[model samples]
Target chain A: MNRHTDTPAGTELLDLPMPEPRTCPFGPAPVYDRLRAEAPVTRVACPTGLTAWLVSRYADVRDVLGDAERFSSRPGQVVHLMAHADPERPIGEGEFTRMDGPEYQRFRRHMGPEISSPRRLAKLRPLVRAVVDERIGALAAAGPPADLYQDFAIPVTTASIGGLVGVPYADRDLFHTAASGVFSDVTDQVQLAAAVRPLQGYLFELVRRRRVEPEDDALSRMVARAPSAEPPFSDVELVAMSAVMLVAGFDSTATALAHGVLALLNDPGQWARLRDDPSLVPGTVEEMVRLFGGGAGIVREATVDTEIGGRPVAKGDYVILAIQSANHDPEAFPDPGRLDVARDTEGHLGFGHGTHQCFGQQTARLELTVALEALVRRVPSLRLAAPLADVPFKTGTSVVGPERVPVTWDEILPAEGEGP
Target chain B: MRVRADTALCVSTGSCALTAPEVFDLGEDDGVVVVLVESPPDEQRETVGRAVRACPAGVLSLAP
Candidate 1:
């Protein structure tokens, strides 16, 4: 699925596996280069009986995502996931991610302080660091020849997510399994509901608890916000929003960590460079996530007649913003193939754009920053146990990354304060 | 150039703060964009431009 070089019989419209389905693991598919160069906006036949105008160019994709008025996100992410009988997700009461206009803004504003405010990020920093370091320590204790994806990366991210959504330490196991189930590939209504029911019940109870006694977390913050809500928010709405944070934040952040680690370790020079200069970790986080992380492409349905790059897109048309392709767009990123740690990686469409941008991006950044910085600092001898090509990547799921980042380290490196 | 930020529109992606730390920051409590240097110096003009461009929400704008 790497190159997509099967010579598009000229009529074979694009299907799933949009970006990588790449010639190189380090960058996006060459098909993107050809498509962007040839036809930036082309028709894509979706399994959901929909026709999506796949926008590949950087500016055009940005335009579509930025302009919420013309391009509506109401059809929601399910449009992207609406394959293999994946049922349409009912946009819950407080699930603003799928909403439009004022309804969406109300939730975004209410939850903004708890989840993404600068204050929240600062508050979250220490938690993220402690969690990351603890996870790495566990990884080291478990010994090398480990799967970083499962053992270290996922747990750190899971805990970080727990911190954000206010899942207690003892409850993380139940929360983690349920979180994975909700984001799981199971599309059958019976199976999906089986997964959703328990998690929903747990969240509903949690929200109810938060109402009774507010905690210093996102859910509690929302509970406090409920009474003053314009139309008055309900407990159900709070639970739904918490699920949104869980479902949206969980798999993507974990994958980013795994993918970023793979991207760095794949290039030894870059790995060594990062290990040498800890200061490079922050910029390196941006670069790696730009190349290897970010969410799956965003789906926006046009509300009114619009033209993308002069292409006539009638109202009701769907547009798949190929974010990975846009990130690799040479026009926006010079030598986009090369991973330059110091490169100005700002404005990479990794976290997406506009009013409906990723809600957990700052949290993701904090996790990535602490995890990568600590991983390099703690495991200086870290090396991939398997080559990137041999390492199976997750193209099957909506969240793309190495399925299992197997790595081996020679010794456990101690921190400055710890006993040598 | 003078900068203006509309907190109402901010999703708090924090790109502005990350891009031009001197010119912009995220508010401690609300996480909306806070303009540090409303009019940045000559040395920071390019970074400021980038910070504005980097904002996905179109929350930041520069006036010459």
Candidate 2:
């Protein structure tokens, strides 16, 4: 049957096409581009046998995200063919991303104290900076003609996630392998689950350890609050939350840093401005977040059939909230194609909008700021080692970033008076 | 006239503090949100708004 065809009232539902991969490595998706231009909200078939309303306009996407009552995050609402296969199991209890209402709030509460307050984030800044410096130092020492993604991005991400999860640095290789398996797209559902289960097991063990001996990290604090009295999360919940934090914390920053560096090298004006004034690092980081557009959309499922943007969405429809696309909508951002570090980007949806916005944003910001600052300061002459298009990008997944970004720069030695 | 933050809603992403440090400041201890200036200088309006828009939370606002 021809899918996705009806308005909220009676207008014929236009079959919206997908857009080119604006941020993905797999070239452009014209279906979405057509929809964005012609039908702000249109219906389309998902990979699964269901149809969904695609909200492309900036304002509409924001409206949907802000009004969670209309849109629910429950896993059962829409079948995430990729998330789970059995339909019976459907992921796990710690899948907080799929939670709504009081459940979401409670899970968020557990995480709130960990990342929300600036003081907690400040404690993380030094560690993040050290990771950034270590990665950059390794890259610099390796000399030019190095893929920044491998030498810098991977190491920093590994270190940052390990530090946050209170894992020893020595254990990072195991965690990194587990992470790759969980997030890998090449693998089938069972394989992916196999990868995730082990990591989940590790996190549960970590939570159990923290319960007995509270440490100075997020895990301990979470366990200390769990004390088997309050709205307590089980051992599984704690571990799942930690795993989520680790994955979300590490992947997003690494992707953004890898892409952000490439974007800066391509645009010399921004690089010069940032190089000249190190103070702009933080603001520049925000602008970069807006521009990278990784994991371009957040999928939301309608709890009941509802009218959205004048389109009739069936109950359990997959509503793709195109955060990255909206951020670049012409109406919200004039000439959205341009990347201006100093632009007034107060409305961009990079970290998302409303209650479900990223909890680790503050930490993400600190990490990116430090990484960028160190990069520009240490490597003034940094440039692409190969043609921009030739750079390989991460493939077949929601999160978009360069898999290998080769960079070259003229070597500059410290002044003779500087300590070696 | 752009780049205003609601003290109650501000989660301290530091977009404002980073965009216009002259106008925004964070608590030293917990980094709870605070305003160094209710109104930023005219010259910084656009950049400040950029800061506001960059906020992950909708805590920042702007004036036309």
Candidate 3:
């Protein structure tokens, strides 16, 4: 939805939507299947007029993502939801995801130790479980037929992220609102502005508060490190980092939880299997990550001319790695459409493959595991309130899934402290 | 199976330690790879292989 101002004259390019539209709720857009088979490395246009070689074969996708030097992790390649920042300026330090080489490693040295540290995640598990229980309790109290997407999935993810990043309890609404606006549509200018402007002001204020008073949370840990570190982290950079934690991390897990639950409810045997055997939760979470990778494409720009799946890709050509399609590739995943919760889903590009793979993937797996285990345990007879076709899905965006899931249950289980 | 990890290459994604804690761990100071057991039991081999494959940095390995 950017202005598409850079379109070149002469030849035409296909302006395919990044997430595209899904013919089946459970699979990626059908076009990807054909693209993988017919033209695994084919050119497609982004909203910004950059023509990219959309790579669909699992092996090619893996190679492109895994080779950091050959394929750069620059920022412009993203099929972005938010309005673009100035493209001319140098990528400041601490903007780690888009950075490559030593600069990327520098941020990782500071952040990797904090966010996914063994000690931090141990404390995080119970907090996430508590959030899951609280949301489920509220959902049960509200209705036998409840809207899971709005009422359950969104709140749980928003609250957990708020707690993870040390955002105050009162400001979680602002976080949730901004996430909703950005995920809904890129074309809607009013919603885009509302999502962007307020969050910037609020994050700066939050960072200032963390400066004076550090807490046992990810942001505070970074802030505590900032003052002592070499070439210290600027407050603006900290704000940008926090925004990514809240907003980028927000919808990924929510959609996984929402879509996983929705899909499970539709498959009664699978739902019952999970409820009966809690030990399967880990593998089920992996399956959820596989099917609902939460992204359609993860883009990269080639550093030099290279061949992918036998097709020649030119230097500076953007390669759109189809994460969702790669997960469903028959070469990688046998019986790709079938949801086998116990399937060996390792090496799937669900969290992405390498270099810039998801920093919070382990936490996301833990979150999905705890949430799914709790839901299946608390509401054994849970089922969908509406038909699968009737459900509204998020389209034309990176993090894609069902927007709303109306669910119903026969009986709700009480919280541990509450009487049966 | 003998598990090997290169801490210098470890980015601390924690996939190895989380998947096969019996074989690997993260350093308390810097959160890099730390191998707990060089040769794991036959019972531990499967998870250890998973740990090796799951390491984002491709630093974890095992002797055949």
C-alpha RMSD between model 3 and the true structure: 3.4
The collision pairs in model 1 are: A2-A22, A22-A29, A117-B31, A118-B31
Ranking by lDDT: 1, 3, 2
TM-score, per-candidate, Cα-based: 0.90, 0.81, 0.90
Query: Over the full model, what C-alpha lDDT does candidate 2 score relative to the true structure?
Result: 0.68
DockQ of each: 0.48, 0.18, 0.55
Where does model 3 exceed 4 Å of error?
A: A1-22, A80-89, A180-194, A228-231, B38-43
Q: Model 2: number of clashes?
A: 25
What proportion of the real contacts between chains A and B does each prediction keep?
Answer: 0.47, 0.15, 0.45
For residues B1-64, write the lDDT of model 3, one tens digit per residue.
7877766666668888788877787765455678988989999888899889997667878887
lDDT of 1 by residue, A9-77 (tens): 453567744445235766666778888999898877655555577888889988888899999887766
Docking class of 2: incorrect
State in Å the error of residue A206, model 1.
Answer: 1.2
Instruction: For model 2, state the Cα shift of residue A390 in Å.
Output: 0.9
Residue range with the least summed lDDT across 10 consecutive positions in model 3 chain A: A1-10
Candidate 2, position B51, lDDT: 64
Q: What lDDT score goes with residue A208 in model 1?
A: 84
